[model samples]
Target: MTGSVRAAHTALALTNGLLIDGTGAEPIRAASVQVDSEGAITYAGPDSLAPEVASGTTTVNVGGNAILPGFFDCHVHFCLPGGAADIGLTMALPASLKVFQIAERMRTTLEAGVTSARDLMGVDVGFRMAIDAGVIAGPRLVLSVGIVSSTGGHGDMTQLSGINVLPYLQSPGCFPAVADGEDQVRAMTRRILQAGADVVKIAATGGVLTPTDRPDDVGMSVAEIRAVVEEARSRRGGVHVAAHAQGRRGIQNALDGGVDSIEHGYDLTTEQRAQMVDEGTFLVPTLSEVMGSLDPSAGPVALAKKALWQGKARTNFPAAVAAGVKIAAGTDAGAAPEHGHNLRELGLLVDNGLTSMQAIVAATRHSAELCQLDHLVGTLEAGKRADIVVSDGNPLSNIQLLGDPANILLVIKDGVVAKDRAGFLTDRPVSPR
Candidate 1:
């Protein structure tokens, strides 16, 4: 139950469960999933049609639990500690202490049934490499490494005291990401790419937390955003660009500049929603971050901004959902809710307009597609990575069940059991091959 790899029975199967599969399809009754030793799913369907596993393969009876694909969060910040005074707390802490906090957060996040995450900023490539090397327990990471911002933009750490505290938020592999015109934005984008960014994150508008600007204030111009998109696309693998677009003008500019996804769309217009659907653009609604930003410990400016936007966020997100825009679940963890509570976003999505199953797909398949890992994860099926989760009960009836880590019965990432709350693996002895 605690090892990095299963000892004798490398392959696994969870029989006698209801499988949700993350496909937005109706649940399959009497389901079973078979994972081969290589961490690939060999079978995932009705128990009647499931192929027989090898003799030594461990089989777990889930006691009629709900089986699902491991969840994925599209937007998260491992560096922030999800505190009301995040900026002050980060500035006060030493880099070494922050690293330990990041590790612990990642562990809790994985145990909460999140198998993969896309870190928007503040995390470097080293963390991803460490997880891949099995040096630590964490969800598979896709890192952005840095955020591209114009001077005094949301990502800029310069305060009224004339201190730039950006160093506290980044590791050695990250760059100081403040740029102005198109040329500077392009150079900054290249530097971030060289530092191993999987996605290019740019702030197209201001933010609530930054004292230097208001959320409605435009940050990057259309040409500057386009520069970032062009540079990222020129890369060998064609990196995608995500814009921190909160206001209507910034959102329109980002869409015009051809960014792949819009983050924190607090003022999304009806035209923007239609445009997003037509262009297949994804909307990552960080509702939890914005709504939870009304912490008493936050500064007066931040509190006021958060209060103003709270109503708009509730309205705009539901409108976007009704407009048929592609939705991806991203809590913007480390801002309000901590990493392990990522499932809270699903419930928020359901409240906004999405049904329970639609919200699950947004967290799983849609999020995977946004992270560019859909081919490997997102759904329970053959030829996919065996990143699976078994919930204590059906989430369709009560989606809030997934909001608590205690309800997550089993978490298997790449055929490795990361968390087994019900002793599904440890309770039974492995059969000899």
Candidate 2:
């Protein structure tokens, strides 16, 4: 019963581990998790309270490791491979070759124990369908498909030379749109939705990576941003709107325009944080983006822009935490940090004033809430999908342990063993009795 747990038809039971349920609660020692064949967790609590396992059920003894809900990254980019300053590397590559690299990044992300992620841009619906149909391996994705930026804004992939080659790179389900005014914003929003966006991403401010604009410069006008929100609600009533907001003015504009989440909130004032808390807006502090972009190799334009905002996150992030703004984990993978390094955000969250448990909650529960997927996953409670991770060490004691894939001993998604470094389930194939 105690061996390598196979991804099979039989039930799964993980026992003898410390469970952090992703609810900001204290960890329970000697916990057990029971996943039914349909991939729903039937029980998750202290081992003494776990029901008796039936015959043929694979029982995994975690050996006092930490059991947690599968992590989530609220912001990531599967299109751009991380560790580079060139956001437009995919611009030159043909779509055929680019897709294969994107698929590999998805697999790498899955192996890192991230079960779900919200892709802010560059991932198309084809990738999502492939993962769902078992054609590829990756996290459950909530895709924006592409970003919406104003002329010369951050999402504008156009070169300063004025040649707009972005349309050439548009695939079947990906469409990045740039508009100048309310009417254009509305039309572009419709185009993004028509291209199969689960969420609408609007650039409320400039970004560090874009050469055309400064991060503090406001990108979209208030009316233009409102137009996007209005169009998104009309197209998909429950669809979420996220803003790539870094500066204070843009953050205020996004909040005023009714954005659901703020990405890379670099220069937030106390009033803005209070406003965000009042509006129930989530903040995805992508510390990984800041940390990863610090590479001097990225060039002077990028390095100077990065330097402008680098010291700000260290001060602002902890203050946002103290001001009670809802936090979610987002690494901005592909922008700076690589895909598999998603969990590094959790440790950065800890360093930014969140406790280890709170950091886990930010990655798991808060992220799910931001993605509007909390009911299906995010926690270890019964009735939730059996998306879980068993780490070789306790993350509460050393949160950085979750950052390393080697320490992730097991990864289960929807009751199927995705990765198992430990021999918890038997290698024997399930017999068709």
Which structure among the candidates has the greatest lDDT? 1
Mind giving the per-residue lDDT tens digits that candidate 1 earns over 49-129?
988889888888887889999999889988777866456677778778888889888989998899998988889999999
**Regions more than 4 Å wrong, model 1:** 1-9, 86-89, 428-433
Please report the candidate that would top TM-score against the real structure: 1
Give the true-structure RMSD of model 1.
3.0
**Candidates' C-alpha lDDT:** 0.88, 0.85
lDDT of 2 by residue, 71-176 (tens): 9988988877777535356566777887888888887787788999899888889888998877887889999988899888888888877767555444445765
Output the lDDT of residue 362, model 1: 95
Deviation from native of the Cα of residue 398 in model 2, angstroms: 0.5
Clashing pairs in 2: 3-423, 3-424, 3-425, 4-423, 4-424, 4-425, 5-425
Q: What TM-score fits each model?
A: 0.96, 0.94
lDDT of prediction 2: 0.85
User: How many clashing pairs in candidate 1?
Assistant: 0
